[model samples]
Target chain A: MAGTDPIHQFVISDIVELFTIGGDGTEGSGLTFSFTNSGLFMVVSVVLTTTFLLFASRNRKLVPDRWQLAGEMSYTFIANMLRSSAGSEGMRFFPFVFSMFAFVLVGNMLGMFPYFFTYTSHIIVTFGLAMTVILVVTIYGFARHGLKFFKLFAPSGVPAYVLPIVIPIEIVSFLSRPISLSVRLFGNVLAGHITLKVFTGFVVSLGALGALGWLGALLPMIMAVAITALEVLVSAVQAYVFAVLTSMYLNDAVHPSH
Target chain B: MVTQAFAQEAETPTEQNLDAAIDATRGEPVEGAVGHDPTADTHATTEAHGGEHDSGVFPPFDPATFPSQLLWLAITFGALYLLMSKLALPRIGGILENRKHIIDADLAAADASRQKTDAAIAAYETALAEAKSKAQGIADQNRETIQADLAAKRSAVEADLGAKLSAAEARIASTKAEAMTHVDEIATETAQTVVTQLVGDVSTDSVRAAVAKAKE
Candidate 1:
């Protein structure tokens, strides 16, 4: 067992291990299918977001209450982001963008709690989301523009001699979009959580030492507080960045002019 | 300090057994043994111990846990997408749309009422101006009529006074003439009495002729 390790906070624990359907697995006999803390937190975020939306707009008054105003603001915030990035045509994918934004935002925020898991910090989850966005954009591009979608890789003013170099580079860059997108989010979140944990570990180690050590621990404690505040801002910003990039990619699929 | 702790965990019998189990599961020789853990499922055992937990560097990178994580992510993402697209989002959209419509209707109604109030004020001003002009016209007309009537009355009064003055003058002239004749007769009578008393009475014809000559 790993004891008192700050990195242990990220470990996904199996809450319920299953063999066949809901059947209990014997000890180390068969491979265990399990529900994890990561999954639990994801579901929690979904529920929270859904309930917030429902309760906020239940009254739907012309003069909005606080809850209703909050709901409206988030809606308009995403709507405007999509509209500005992808134009009026981008409003069709409003729900998708909003969902991604809320999911990431809530997940990051909830993970800031003392013992909660941050699924967005995981490469698999973030990559899955990124791939989904890319897949949707590719499919939509092909569906809307047919063969003309391939023109997105080729610039309009490029010389025929430069086409060989430019097209490959563009294709490579285009393919790297998902990787960058996923990594940026995951790296930011993971780094923030790790830094927070490290600082906290410092506080614990110092406090455990002695009277002088407790006094020294105050510095890292202060740093942890500041970092927590920064992480909150980062969480919101990362969610916004994800949503905006998704919109931009969707815009490329829709227009694909340059 | 952290390195020493990890090294201690590595040296433990339970840690060795756990590492062997992980190695057996992955079918790899446990040759490189510093700061490396093959399986994420080792956390399940560590968590079961209740007093300690596994501290992998990057647990999410573990291949054994990818299936379940991806599966759960897919299910959750699918559920979220459907909820947002079909239900939650549309409801919010409806609320926003309805609010916009209501606000627009209210603003339009306010504008129309304001316009009506402006028109009413304009009409009131026009009526007041017309009434003031009409009153002034009536007063001017009445002044002109009164001035003309006064002029006619004054002229008629002057004419009647002139006629009466002339008549009085003529009567005075006739009275003076009669008085002169009487005075002449009286003078002749007085002279005749004086002459008679003195020597002899003068003749009436002679007195009358003398009086007439003197008057002339």
Candidate 2:
């Protein structure tokens, strides 16, 4: 009965009280600087990613050790993904793309632990990431191609008679990239966690009914274990999806035609 | 009994929560109910903490936490980007590049050594062939020299044997001539003796003439 509320885990609670600046730090009040569980996890993600990468590269062996190989593999994975989707010129944005990938992946992995806040489950966080990608695409597209960047919506091969219908659809699709990107990740993580919690809650509830209850609880327990494994896979896949999509969007900035 | 009561109490709230969730989805508010909606519970908790902005919303959908979350994200992500670009990526790339260079250099060295070995083998074969031909030439020269010496010695021996055979034939001819002379002498003496025994003496010239005439 205690952990039955699937929504309880997502509650944001402040760990340290800092200051309320403008109004009262409420809905429309102003900005609040107090460090919350979300902030702590963000800090944890940054530290963990930095330490792992730095420690892995410390040896610089020709025949790499396990940790070093792991580090190199992650680097190559993201680099190749960006280069293939975008282009070699897109290597300019490698730092940004790599950072986004590592942050999301590490954050998702950290959230797998009990009592850890999943930052990617929040729409604002994923939206912030998606918006940053869009902003880079838009700003770089304009800076690089000027007025010709609009050619993205009008694609080259379409018949002139269908331009009127095709242009708006293309524009809508282009504009919805950030929304789709953010919502896809957030919805997946949110739903997966909630489902896992609900199934686990069923096990606890059933186990309280004496011997018969204990026997019935086995099914839910198995289901909960299976769902946990699925969630782990989902977390990794979602992180990869975020990076791949980010590269594809950045590709538009590099080559805006088709 | 008490355990059973507790189990029943837990089950009742779960059923009520499910109904409240269904009702909330239908856009109908359940009135005069305590802890019926889970979001309401979250709302009460936030309100109790004097946070006015997220009082009646799901925590994820609440707008009040956006500013801090964004600020922290920018800080942490920016830090990650700086650390990676400056420190980690370049090092790994360098290691890979260095390994490639070393392996290539090693392959080239091995190729050069293989060529050297091939050249040495070819030289060794040439030397062996030359030695074999030289040995054949030496053997042929020795055989010719021995055959010539044998021919010379055989010719000298045949000449020496021919001279000895001629001398032996001359000696044999002389011995035959002497024996024939003795035979004639013996015949003359015997003739003389018989003549004397029969009737007085016979002359040597006559006897000789008679013998020569008889031999003729």
Clashes in model 2: which pairs? A27-B53
Q: Per-residue CA lDDT of candidate 1, range B1-216, in tens?
A: 344434654666376665655654555555445245545335434545442223334686865456667878888888888888887888888999998898899999999999999999999999999999999999999999999999999999999999999999999999999997789889877776777789876777886777678767
User: What DockQ values do the models have?
Assistant: 0.28, 0.29
Quote the TM-score that chain A achieves in each candidate.
0.93, 0.96
Highest TM-score: give the candidate number: 1
Candidate 2 lDDT:
0.84
TM-score of model 1 (CA atoms): 0.74
Give a tens-digit lDDT track for model 2, residues B1-216.
223433443456666654744543444665544344545454444545553334456779977777778878888877888988898778887887888899999999999999999999999999999999999999999999999999999999999999999999999999999999998999888888888899888898798778878887
In CAPRI terms, model 1 is classed as: acceptable
Candidate 2: fraction of native contacts reproduced: 0.61
